[model samples]
Target: MSSPEQWTHPEPGEGPAARAAQPSPEQVIAGLRATTEGGAELTQLLTPEGERVASPQFDRYVADIDGEALRGLYRDMVLVRRADREANAMQRQGQLGIWVPLLGQEAAQIGSGRALRKQDMAFPSYREHGVAYARGIDFRELMGIFRCTDHGNWDFKAHGFHPYTIVIGNQVLNATGYAMGQKFEGKVGDEDGEATIVYFGDGATSQGDVHEGFVWSAVYDAPLVFFCQNNQWAISEPTERQSRLPLYQRARGYGFPGIRVDGNDVLACLAVTRWALDECRHGNGPVLIEAFTYRMDAHTTTDDPTRYRLSDELEAWKLKDPIERVRAYLARNGHADQPYFDRIQAEADQFAADLREFTFNMPEPPPERVFANVYAEPSAALDAQREEYLAYLSGFATAGER
Candidate 1:
């Protein structure tokens, strides 16, 4: 039996009926809802209706979190949502190439993000905007990559965050290697030792690189946390297509523990992540967390979800909106008032405006910028491409003179 503190992860029921039943494309509209013998498959701290529930194991981790911390978490979620909304709007206005919106995953990102110690590093996939926010990354610097101006102008080491990795599951290898390096440097098995956290989506798990990363991390007992946001869809493909069992179960095969948490429940995410990171620092690492959540928007601004996913499904998830539940919890418990909520909205508006202004005024990258890192000594191919680009640009200028 599982402890009250550690909510039991319900296994898929066995038998002929279970074997005969497979969720079809039509059933994808079922909103990815699954239940366990214990009630739900996920460990939840807050319900969809804004009610706070007790979890002994997770609650022990967050015992010190008071009303102020709860309010701060709410504020973080609000600001992140605002920034994401602004980014989407900017993309639609042609100010950006594309945006991978983290619309419904704010709790998943922010809660886990805040759990990291200063020495810990986080490796992000393309859509960890909320995590970037939690790291105190200047929103201005983060937008440069999407602006087509600079390839992430922020300092990776200082922020303890690497540049967003676009390749599927590639960053998992990078994070694993970094964690191994930390172990080599004798940074493991201590409260002050560094740890590594890597973010990858459900889709990325299908890639061999992620599998290899799992093997390496487990074998070495690297101080690492694999935070997988199972947002139902890996782009257009549902997570149903990616695994024979729940994504969390994969951790067992690698000789580590895995748990599923309600991604929308920020308190659970924070407590769970804190415990996991501590476990890593104490040398019981390479833990996997499957944050079960839904993506409320299209994969990117360029994609339309309507063609594949059902509207009803999106509506169903909306009731479980991460921000709303946090807000309600705050209000119901008298942790925050209406005036405070208003102020947050006002602040979010200002943030969006400021973000928009800076984004619009962002300077274009010079042609030479692309070839800057081609070689320590300039390569012939790079020089040729640079010269050709300059020549082509000049031709347009010359034509204007005529």
Candidate 2:
């Protein structure tokens, strides 16, 4: 079998051999048809129960990690999945306006998130709840945005996690720009200097900002990693509707290396991301990681998967659930048992209960507080406008309001 090194790059100007060398266009079409027909499954790293599978490129890193670390990685996936489920349920119960469930992509997020060094920073899309969890942000804080409260209440500098960017792919440019700043500050080469990672979805690949992000990162040799979790669907559209070629292949065109990792495998995701970040820290410029996984839930709580997809398709992905696969592997290896499983479940439940209490008790910001920080300094014109607005608001106040 060809090693990951052999599969890492294609001949210049040639497409991915597996994709391009398919016997016929009819075969390609048939393969996609099979996926939709529930005959084919997406790439996966862990089985429904967690077990370690070897991949040539990732073997180097995974070999060095201890069994305890592997168990921790598995635990992170489980906790994140539980949080995703709770958020979805909260949204459905009308407690939140919307929720994006990271149901099947926990490995992609957790693995990559765990790979970050303390100095490294991450820019995330709104669906990056797992990343947020890894960064030590309280999961309930994520509810603030979807709950129609604050934009981002956390400090990015303190946590090394930027506020989740809702505008598709916009954070890519911001991440690149920050990395370029780091390079200017002489922070790209040394082991101690910071690196940046940005996450975006497969659908965002079609946007202009994503392309622009690539251009800037490549041109400046920024210490940035563009992590794309290709979860098969972009809202209601399938990957086929977005591009003809696999998304990873696009990286070579811009003078950077790209790797497609089985995103469903936490170990693989961690290995790949750690390697990519180290490459950047070593002055290798930017790298793109296309994490091949699936979104086993609706695009958001407001979405109806049944309207545009099939139950069998979701079932196929369920077999590759990131958390289950690790658990399976651990059990098989005699590294984990029912007691360990019970403890983890209890921890997850406690987390959910704490989050529920915190979310319900979250204090609302005062209405005038919105205007307090709108400007660095007060201007006469702005002050007059504010006064007029206050007057208009007070017009509706009762006699005791003064």
Candidate 3:
């Protein structure tokens, strides 16, 4: 098996710009944002300037949700962002080995995650902290994975959110298989039909697993929604480096409907995702939603994005920040006051504080914890290895002292 550093992330076979001979990051993102197809515009509800645009198709999906629900969504986003920031801080403070930051993609996660029904399941990528929060999965559940103290400590089935998949594109297949099972069990074509949603990034679309997942979902007509958080960059590479057309277009080729939404706009994301999920439940499923957003921080704690992207790109995306837009909209329309903002801020602080308290106090898993989940029954080879490991540990009298 290949180590993490040895994994080959081959570029998403060159687009038209590939022949242009090593374009700059700015040039790459510019081309990626262009209309590669029939000038399909991104579906937007809230603009960077805090304007509320009308989307006739998606408006009705959220029309029944009143101002109170909007306030709760905003509050959820604030707390999620605070938790994400704290997770990054934990890494910097040496409490974790690494953390994948989802700084600017808050709306994409919260919007889709909140749209899920109790019966629906979600398969997530590692940076889905916001989605985890929306699904009521506490930050501590993710801490184990980030800290390297445990691969995963949460019960995914219980939470309706699966364990975060570190291997890119793996969750795509997992969700597809789960949805296929739901189909085999006859969960489709009804108002209460169960659906499955899988989350991945623009980068994962280049992977074979994602493509196969799409094919399987389409072939089986599984009640599935493919949520792609196209956060512009897949680590150091931009979306254009992954595909020539916007990611949503790929769904059409697999014989399913696809749509692109402004990932930074919470309302639009919520509406679009709700629409897609409903379509899945009604048996017209296997929908693809390309959330057009940007990753505002390093891919992970160990990466330095400044080495690849320009300062101007970051500045531009900041104006369209998910939380800031909702906050601005609420204030503009008087849905919330300064007191409400202050209360939400306090709640967010408390949430982050609890996260820190729990993660800091969580006991590190024992060395044997690694061997416990390898199999359902005793394995002779693993048992021998475990004995050898214990014997090696006994050789050092000061092993536990550290």
Instruction: Give each model a TM-score.
Output: 0.87, 0.86, 0.87
lDDT of 1 by residue, 26-108 (tens): 23223244411112558898898899889878899888888899999999999999999999999999999998899999999
> Ranking by lDDT, best first?
1, 3, 2
Answer with 2 or 3, whichever has the higher lDDT.
3
Q: Comparing candidate 1 with candidate 3, which one achieves the higher TM-score?
A: 1
Higher-scoring candidate on lDDT, 1 or 2: 1
Q: How far is candidate 3 from the true structure (C-alpha RMSD, Å)?
A: 6.8
The TM-score of candidate 1 is 0.87
Worst 10 residues of 2 by lDDT: 1-10
Give candidate 2 misplaced runs (Cα > 4 Å): 1-25, 28-30, 33-49, 372-402
> Native-vs-model 2 lDDT?
0.80
Per TM-score, what order, best first? 1, 3, 2
Off by over 4 Å in 1: 1-32, 35-39, 371-402
Residue 382 lDDT (model 1): 81
Best by TM-score: 1
Local distance difference test values of all predictions, in order: 0.86, 0.80, 0.84
